[model samples]
Target chain A: MVNTRNMVADNYTPESVAEAVRKYDGVRRKQAIGSLVRSLHIDNIDVVASYGEDAAVIQNGRTALLLAADGIWNKLMEVDPYWAGYCAILVNVHDIAAMGGRPVAMVDVLSASDDAIMTEVSRGMHDAAVAFDVPVVGGHLHPDAPYNVIDVSILGVAELENIIYSSKAQPNDAIIAAIDLKGRIHPSAPMNWDSVTMKTSDVLRSQISVMKDLGERHLLTAGKDISNPGVIGTLGMLIESSGVGAVVDLTAIPRPDLDALGITFEQWVRMYPGMGFIMTANRSDVETVCKKFRKTGMAAQVIGTVTSTKKFTLVKGEQETVLFNFCEEGITNI
Target chain B: MVNTRNMVADNYTPESVAEAVRKYDGVRRKQAIGSLVRSLHIDNIDVVASYGEDAAVIQNGRTALLLAADGIWNKLMEVDPYWAGYCAILVNVHDIAAMGGRPVAMVDVLSASDDAIMTEVSRGMHDAAVAFDVPVVGGHLHPDAPYNVIDVSILGVAELENIIYSSKAQPNDAIIAAIDLKGRIHPSAPMNWDSVTMKTSDVLRSQISVMKDLGERHLLTAGKDISNPGVIGTLGMLIESSGVGAVVDLTAIPRPDLDALGITFEQWVRMYPGMGFIMTANRSDVETVCKKFRKTGMAAQVIGTVTSTKKFTLVKGEQETVLFNFCEEGITNI
Candidate 1:
């Protein structure tokens, strides 16, 4: 393997990375999410929490039912139908996993204009479902639709007390980011890293279970799976939700060889790694939690610290830059 | 109020009704549904039934969790976003209700190209949510989408033993169609018969409860709510699912004043009457079931009889036309 240590040392620039993340489409698309939540929200008996969280929690007697839905962007669908279908299930599963819940089943609503596209999309969905051991139970199909769109919603169950939320991070905690950097960028979709698709099911499941273990043991105060917004942007969202701030050290983030991947340091911070998460843990529990992710074949590093000030800052050696100020300009406005 | 008896006597024409139902857009859109189902289907453990059924059933413990998603057509959304949103929730609730299930909660994925459209859609969704008493728990939003769309999926629960299925109808059964004809066509949406919106909550709840009562009492063998395909087309689907046939006497179908509404006989049969269902039951149980619907402020009529041969026929006096033959041309091919 090419040495990543030197590349990490050479690219420790604060301004470049912040600018790339600020302009990333993955991060920009989320600006309207908060306003949409405000418009659609309604008071009800069963709902515990709706928007501003990974999964909506519904009270179901002794257990809490987690409900969440995600749609693939049209741009992605145009580039790769299979990846679009796979991501539809992948992102929804992560939504449940991020909330400290066990994914039970999923249903999909697919609207495609042609048969060839539908076959490829369903193949991707089926393969992912089998690999994750989660069934695609039932869904609606619009075969003669005018355009191609895939939307998936998942249901999961969790103990009411054991659930971890994005809005619960505490001050003075360590921000830990864990990611599998063994795979290359997907050929069909440049923004996606193809780590889980090539890896054995055993390895993928183990990586997913690490989050559950952390939640069960109460090791993480707040956590989120690294999604379309990439690692730093995801951490920014968690910090925003928790009403706190974070200071991240650019050199400490784990990454693969930048030269071999033919990508810049700024691009890496904005790309969606196939299997990754950003979490906040108490200073005392940080080491043990990082050790668990490392055991699952991921590079785990304590790259930042949670702060009391409502500003997200990026630090590279002596240089520092403000990434987000939650008090002024919000990410999701949640 | 007009004399119902005189109106019914002057407007009944089986040949005209058959032609109208055959050409209705609600009935025409369903022709493509079966081909789509055939393409997307895959083997899974939890999925009990899909496609031609009202709601897809997933096995969950001793009970079954009914899951379904529905999206309003673009034409409807352009004309009335509020009605589009209302129908999105209305259709999902009906899917579960048709299956003898109790709806628990729902999640929506909404995309709007403009603010006025988004506000109207949300207003309609909020009103229907309160009317049905099923909360909109959580969902995703695409605030800057190029096109407008509203897709909703619901979760419901039913006892495995009491869950009604569309494939359980038997030969020699009486076909019972129940509809609330106490309202006029919606001015904004001509195809939509505005029944439940004008009724009191008590009346609306009772109308929905009639299906659950039928399932619990084992009064109906197979059933489905009248959807875009209207009354006759909905019955055609039920017959197809049951692997049987049906024959209806045009004189027996209940309808409002066709002359006053300025709609032809064919249009009335094909129009999507809000809060309508077509069910099959033994001759002995027909009267009792009709009484239950009538008590809920609906008009119930024994319109047809189930047959062993797979053919759907409509007769008015001596004139008859074959609408569908499951052995030859199936509606949904369930």
Candidate 2:
């Protein structure tokens, strides 16, 4: 009796997990984003960075203005309008923070056919706005509509010299991921890992400020928040955007107890963690950056190392599998 | 015999026309906007101005960051997705320009049920982005949806000291309206005045730059773009926001052959002009400001004067009618 449950259960190879994540809908949907970006790209005088970054950086004198927008998924809107609305703001704030900026304000565009749905959405938006301390300024509202939709855009600010970008990762940098793993999967949505809602406002705010600190200190080379795509997929995106590659160790990826949560390793690697980020930093600064995130009550660990091969790979025990080959296939191709 | 036809049919009794415009659906729909604003207002660290203005302003160091989001009407989306997408970007750009800011970049959230609508909408967005030289960066896309909707948000930058706000008009200030009347009604939507698509990019760019000039010179006290609620309703919103009032001489409003367009005097005030702005300026600077707009190929005229009575009145030959009273009833109450 050689601890059969532990060995057999955790013995799943990396190739199987890699293939599933590569073919996941969350990752596949991103394939068309690049073409759409190319079609709409134009020369703008004030736009310092656009399609390739988390938020488009606009040069406004000595300050860099961050602008980004996110929409709630239709399925989420149908199941629960409140969560959808909360996530709309949640994702946008993450976008700004991922770029090492402080979110200042937000505007929303909401369309709803039902009054009950509208009220719930508003309630969620209000709760999130208050928690984040970012005002919901002005927006267009469609009161009577056949479908429900919520789109939110945020504006943030950072010093021009201190702003971090997604295209500056260097080879041999340590890849670190900081995630708040103190929450469980949402009862309504299996893929959603609820973390922020249950925490105090101070805790959430502290977690958001860690990125800004890293930006100011120039501790991180490149970064992105974990979104609909899970941890591994998000790292793939960061690597692709930086025109570099990464090799992530499966065991080092921070995760809650999958067995207790009734989820598998593969599913855990493909689910969106509500409050999580993937970042790259120099080996010398890794300890300082991770310590900053740890102070905010998040688990930070070195999950991988940036590489020059232009390919994303996953390793589990002695098995290794390629998730994406940027030379031929890209995540967003931004 | 009464010379009704020769006496300028467009210059009808202001009382009757005012009543018709007050009851129009375009204006009536705006009545709900105020309640929504009151519900959403929150305290933020950097938000300087929000609801009731064309764009929300946020303090970003020495600069003011402008953020705004707009959604196309459901009817317009059903009529033509292409025009709907085009208008989405067009209106957001106007929101920034109306605030005397330089537009930086935009992001859009598109919900479509099929590829045909998506293609058309994307094409329209592409055309406008290229024409205006504003890039549509990254945004959310709903590939399979129950309905079609397009919402766009923009980022802009303005000098903190020179930003034009909608709530600063003083009593006795001249109210000026500048509009491009050289356009036809859109074939898909009769209420839309399609001036931008017909003009060359050079002409539109110059027209947009006029607002910047006005801000830099401190020529205007308050300003806003004429949107779906049309010229008068937009003016009503501005006055309500400023907590002031105005009296308009209906005969002074610029119109392009109401007879040729087969529209009534009331209908003209409710039609959405493609390129138009309402500004409140000191009586002394009115002439110079109007001259600047006229040089940019726009028709500019003094149509009213700001008042302290907190009422918007439309006046004609020996007849007058009240449009809105900010003290008792508000348009957007922001």
Query: What digit string (tens of lDDT, one per residue) describes model 1 on residues A18-58?
Result: 88899988888788777666766668887777676788888
TM-score, one value per model: 0.92, 0.94
Model 2 CA lDDT for position B23: 80
Query: Taking the tens digit of each residue's C-alpha lDDT, what string does model 2 give over A151-225?
Result: 999888899777778888899999999999999898778888989889888999999989999999999999999
- The CAPRI-style docking tier of model 1 reads medium
Each model's DockQ? 0.50, 0.65
What digit string (tens of lDDT, one per residue) describes model 1 on residues B79-105?
999988988888888888899888888
TM-score of 1: 0.92
What is every candidate's alpha-carbon RMSD to the true fold?
Answer: 2.9, 2.6
Q: Which stretches of candidate 1 lie over 4 Å from their true place?
A: A1-12, B1-25, B31-39
| Candidate 2 per-residue lDDT over residues B1-334, each given as its tens digit | 6555674455577777777777877777666666667666787667788887789888766778888999999899999988988899889889999999988788988888887888888888988877777788767777667788899998888998888898898899999999999898889998898888888888888898899899999999999999988888888888888888899999899888777777777777788898999999998999999999899889999999999999999998688888887778776554
